[model samples]
Target chain A: MLAIFVEMFSYDFILRALIVGVLVSLCSALLGVSLVLKRYSMIGDGLSHVGFSALAFAMVLNIAPLYVAIPVVVVAAFLLLRLSENGKIRGDAAIAMISSGALALGVFAISITKGMNVDMSSYMFGSILAMDNSDVVLSICLSIMVLCLFAIFYNRIFAVTFDENFARATGINAERYNALIAFLSAVTIVLGMRMMGALLISSLIVFPPLSSMQIFKTFRNVVLSSALLSVGCFLLGLCVSYLWATPTGASVVMANILAFLFFYSIGFARDRMKG
Target chain B: MSLISCQDVTFSYEGRNVITGLNFAVDKGDYLCIVGENGSGKSTLIKGILQLKAANKGFLTLGDGLRLNEIGYLPQQTNVQKDFPASVWEVVLSGCLNALGYKPFFGKNEITRANEQMQTLHISNLRNCCYRDLSGGQQQRVLLARALCASHKLLVLDEPVTGLDPVVTMQFYHLLKEINRAQGVSIIMVTHDIKEAVSQADHILHLHNKQLYFGSVSGYMNTALGKFFSGGGQDACNLR
Candidate 1:
């Protein structure tokens, strides 16, 4: 078994997928705690759907997917934020509107592009073998940016996420921090969509923090454990997919679900013991 | 200079005038209770002073070397905010985040400040406890400790004892009084509990029918409206 695991890394595609997967998982978990606590987890799903449409457009135009998707998704994120803040639309409703609209656009674009039929399933459900060297480099660079930005603004993020009004009253620009979260999340969602697919990427953003919350009470602990859990789950899922001939994205999501249940059971048993 | 002063402050919402030509001043170390009937804009006045809502007209200033960030505020509670997932320590420590502009993390000084405030509120043992798991009174203490961590100059609280039981309310009031008397932190509180406000506050600002009455607590009690409110008439008092 150990030799088989070692042999898997010898393949360039597998190595690239593992690197991107682990990086995406770590980035997702770092932002997930705040997003979940702030009731903004669905933004990830919304932005991923938007990314799908943007990727289809990029494919039709024969441009780099990230170049097309990043700006479009970030704009959509800011638009959603503005609408919610101005009371023009609610958060969930705005997400639903953009998400479904983008999903429809993506399908329409795909139907029109004859050559795009080859990798449609891979785009929708993700394929570990699809990552090239360029994808690995871009993912590495963007993931590092997300991590550094998150670390640099950790305390400010905590303050804004915990109580935005109070944070604003204390001279922190809550809206700016909120915008930063949205923008970074848009980038993360777009990048993860390449590996996890548009449909499954948000689970990467939600499950780790939720699982961590079951075991940890403090924000710092939740963030730290979430990072650990996310990376661990991604690696475990990758291993399972390679050994069992399953889909990588689906496998990772399953690992996350199981981890959530496991942590929840531990929390429940601890509560019982205390009672 | 007074810690907080609002001159001819007029605040409106959706074209409806909430307060027109309201004026009041809170000097350093003064416990000023703002009393008003429902729809009289007591809470709006707090918001206007805190700059959460900008005043439509007139000037509001913080003095005695106090800036907006130096004023600790305990906003009115809502159902959603109470469900936030954080520890008592995190919540309190977040109060000093304003002081760490552009810094990557909280310093040891901020942590020590949070600890001291928790000790002051006697919630040191509950530091690791989840905020959502705390009882109503304990939660209020945690919030008060958070507010304390924000500022030593002035604390602006909007109905800090709203959901507490009578015993807890009295205990909370005594705690505020101690913080005010011992530490010399100025307090500007909004409350409908005329009795408690009268008993605890040194000064009072009564808002009624677009009129502002700023006076000592005893002076306010001597007025006919104050007599009506303190006599348990309850018409002008809103517990909500």
Candidate 2:
């Protein structure tokens, strides 16, 4: 097993995929705690659908997919947030409308252009070879940016997530903080689309914090544990997929699901014991 | 000038007016209780004062070196809010976010201030407790302690004691009175319980069917509406 693990890193593609996967996991977990607590976890799923549609368009236009997908998804995220807040449409309704519409559009675009010479299913379910040297560098920089911004705004995000009305009353601009959260989630979702696939990317933004919440009682503890658990799960899933030739995205999500159930069982047993 | 002053304030929601032509001033160290029937815009008026809602027509000012974000607020809790996953310490420390600006983390003084607030509210031992697991009265005290960590000058609360038992309500009222009188922190609370409102408040702001009244408790007691209430007319506001 140790020899197999050592030989796995002999390939450059594996190394690149592992680096990008770990960084994306960390970014997603940092943003996930706030998003999950705020009941906006589904926004990740919604935005990833939008990213899929944007990627399809970029393929048709023969443009760099990341360049087009990042801004397009980010704008869609802001629009969704704005529409939800304006009371003209509810949050779940807005997400459902946008996500399904984008998914349909992506399907249509793919059928018309035959994915414009790109392997469409690979983009849909993710491909390990997607992380080239340039992709890895971009991923590193963006993940660092996300981590730094989250750290800088940690206290304010805590306030906003707890009670937005009270936070606003106390003179914090809750709307701005909310937009910041949406923006960060958008970037992470877009960056993660290549490895996790658009269909499976949201689990990265959801499962970690939820699993952490089962055992950790405080926000800080939950956040720290979530980050660590996310990276650990991703690494394990990547290695398992490499060994078994399984679908990487599904493998990672399965790992997270198992972790969630395990932690939930622990929490339930603890509660029962206390009783 | 008073610590907080609102003149000719009119608040509306979805283009429907909830409060109109309201004028009230909260002086330094004043304990003002706002009482009104349901749908009488009591919450709207408090939100307007907190600048959470913009008045359709009027000006609101915060004096005594208070800014919009510096005023502590303890909002009425909803079921979802009550289940938030945060520790008592995190909740209290969050009160200092307004002063953090672009800084990422809380400074030592901010943590100390949160500890002091927990101590003041008698919840220092519960700092590590999860907020959602606390009892209603304990949660309210934790929220009050969180609010106290903000400005320590003024607190705006909306229906803060709605779910507590009578004993907890009395104890909470005593805590508020102590904070108001001893600490010299001005308070503006909205309550449906007219009995506690009339008994504990130094000043009263009464709203009924678009009519507004603001004055000292003694002055309010002499008015026709106050006399009606003081004369055992418990159903006066609730009936409307």
The DockQ leader among the candidates is 2
Residue lDDT tens for model 2, B206-235? 997364679999898888788766556655
Root-mean-square deviation of Cα positions for candidate 2 versus the true structure, in angstroms: 2.0
Residue A265's C-alpha lDDT in candidate 1?
A: 100
Candidate that scores best on TM-score: 2
For residues A1-275, what per-residue lDDT tens digits would candidate 2 score against the true structure? 89998999999998998998999999999999999988888899999999999988888788888999999999999998887777678889999999999989988987897644446777788888877788888889998999999998888888888898878887888999999999999999998998899999999999999999999989899999999999999998999899999988889999999999999999999999999
TM-score of 1: 0.95
lDDT of 1 by residue, A36-101 (tens): 888888888888999999988888888888889989999998987777677767878988998999
Backbone clash total for model 1 is 0
Q: Would you estimate the TM-scores of all the predictions?
A: 0.95, 0.96
Distance from true location, Cα of B136 in model 2, Å = 0.7
Tell how far residue B37 is off in model 2, in angstroms. 1.2
